[model samples]
Target: MRTSKTFSIQFWMDTKKSKKSEGLIYARINVDQKRLSISLKRKLAIKQWDSKNQKHLGASQTAKEFNRYLDLSKSKLFRCYQELRDNGEEVTSKAIKNLFLNEESNGYTLHELINYHSIKIENTHAIGSIRNFKVTEGYIARFLKKKRIDDISLSKLNFEFLCDFENFLNAYYPKGHPKAMSHNTVTKHIQRLRKIVTLAYNLEWIKDDPFRRWKSTFDKVDREFLSDSELARLATHHFKIDRLDRVRDLFVFSSYTGIAFVDIRNLTNQNVWIGDDNGNKWITTTRQKTNCKVKIPLLFRAEKILNKYDGHPVTEISETLLPKITNEKANLYLKEIAAEVGIQKNLTFHMARHTFATTVALSNGMPIETVSKILGHTKITTTQIYARVMDHKIKSDMDAVQKRLNEKARKFEEESELKNLREKIVEAEKTKYANLTKEQLIEKLNEVLNEKSDTN
Candidate 1:
């Protein structure tokens, strides 16, 4: 059971932040004699305000619009009060105001929602990913400051608010960044924002999604992968420095095995196993990103890398099969490796995984289903992203079709020649018989048939 509480609302003028002749309107909500004031963000000229009636003084167009807005606001507030009571929530000035302001009973603010979203995902999400959410938190805080508000309730968030935030992100250029955000970068930030807001909706903290009308899209990016020649060049290049040598081996290992840097960083000797049937060595682990199982047969190239670093001092210290290196430092060293080897692409650790997907596996006639499983993809469609980018795969598939068509083309030409010969003989026979009488033609045809039958 819930206690019933008295509730009422009254409109008033707040001129503190307004010009001398105009005053900002606010709705003062009263529950049990306690009061909460909500700024309507609407203003009216002081001279035209009617305090007793709580409306504009005149019937002119602007006055009529202002008065109409006040009327609707009053009716909406009353309805909100009734609904809160009907829902059995404590009827208080803040609760009523929160409800009328577009908040559910939970009454979450923007910053509060950000905090909740952070804590909710902190355990499950990676540190880098959580840092990104913090970046968004800074943006929202700055946006509120730009709008001259300390914070905003999720109820107060609207389509216009989101569009403004997106525009703010589009124009923002932090120091050290060469330019403003790109389409995909902006989309990424916006995507994180949407995810946070969606969490609110999913938790039933908000009745609606402010981003319902807002759409976010990203441009198609060409995922860079190593070609066969490039892979060979990088794999075979030896560096004098032991550090560079180890980094190169790591990158080449990923190229052969399609494992990510983070996953590789955690790999130990225990991850290896001998196959039951074929007795091949295999690396079996779960992808850190998706927590999906990854079981890839260790190719000889990958095995050679493992053997090279087997029981190395670094590996012994880390208790891993390969020497441990920070992903960042390893990639930085790879740039030098690229310059030394004369390969002309922006090389990164992840590109090695892409190379394995296309150049090392898919291009070598490995099945896509098998590739998806090896990559620990929950769905085959996720693997197809790599497939679509392989233009040579597209051409190679068509080459087989083109070969079959070439074979049939010659046979078709021979049949066409025979058809021409038959038509020519028919024309020649017509001409030959045209000069002969009908009886003579019949006698010649019968004589030809009799000779052919007797020979048979």
Candidate 2:
């Protein structure tokens, strides 16, 4: 059975809740015998409220303005009800009240949405991802505070607001910081914001997409890696300090295997196994950041280093494959190692993986596809970033072309010399035949044929 829908708005003063001579004004909504109430955020004396007419009672200017406001509010509430009914939505007093309050029933403020999204993904997302979202939420809150806004309705979010937020992010600095964020850092923050906005839009909390027309661009940065010579120096150089020696060994291991620090830290004996091909040892592990499987054939030097630390106390106690150290200390020790080795590039544990991808694999004619798999890259494009075009690779490519060109030139020269010799012999024979008559030429041809037959 179909039920009739009814909605009506009325203004009244709550005399029972009045603590002083003035009572607070309230709007009461009624739909199909159900009721919902909301404060109108105004106050009037009990004597001024007209119970029968549902309006202010005086003819003064203040009373006239208050009555006009109340009339407008009532009309807007009725329009809200009519629109909801026309749109085939359930016409309830509460729905009409929400519309009148300018708050979408399913909407959330920006910060609230961010927090909600963060909580939703707290367990499923990686720690780095969760931290980034948290930082992004803080940035958004600061931006809103700077604008002196307590909260913004999702419906009020538009392209202009996004632009203003982006501008704020570009100019934002942490406390005691002298410079604003870098270009890529700002891009990252905006990306997180876009994700939250997209979630809201997908959930139908917002009608319009604020980021539809905006394009995010990040600056390309040149990642640093060690050259072959520098890598060799680090590999062969003997450090007097035992701590530096251990760090060097770990870095060299990464340079050979292309495994990242976190994955290496989590490695154990079980991860190393004999490959079916060639019966050589291989490191099979999953990347910590992307969770992509990486299988790398252990190089001679890498195998040697592993064997060297076979019975170390730290490795045994930690139940890890290698001597483990904190990432902070590893990087700090790498700096000292860089200085000791007389290398200019800043040494980080991650750069070891880059060196393995470029210097050890690509420059030595290893296929990019194989390099990408060894490095645990989900995309070849990501591997390409580490495989910068090296000077030696360029030289080797050009040298192969030069060698082919030289061989072609030499063959052409030999063919030209043979052609010139044949032309000279024909000219000499023709000159000798010119001095004789036709009979003499016939005789000479017969004689030459006889001489050739005799020689055969």
TM-score per prediction, in order, is 0.73, 0.73
Clashing pairs in 1: none
RMSD of each: 14.4, 15.1
Candidate 2 lDDT by residue in tens digits, 1-456:
223366567778888888777899888998888998877778898888898998889899999999998987788788888778778787788777767666442357876777678878887776778888889888888888998987777777888888898899888787878998888988898898899889887876665688999999988898899998999999999999999999999999999999888888999999999997678999999887777888888999899999988888879999998989998999999999999999998889999988998899988889999998888888999988887889988998999999999999999999999999999999998887788988988998899999999999
User: Which lDDT value does model 2 have at 343?
Assistant: 95
Residue runs of model 2 more than 4 Å from their true location after superposition = 1-106, 175-178, 277-279, 440-456
Residues 380-428 of candidate 1 have per-residue lDDT tens digits of: 9888878634677779889999999998998999999999999999999
State the weakest 10-residue window (summed lDDT) of model 1.
98-107
Error of 2 at 1 (Å): 43
Task: For model 1, state the Cα shift of residue 128 in Å.
Answer: 4.2
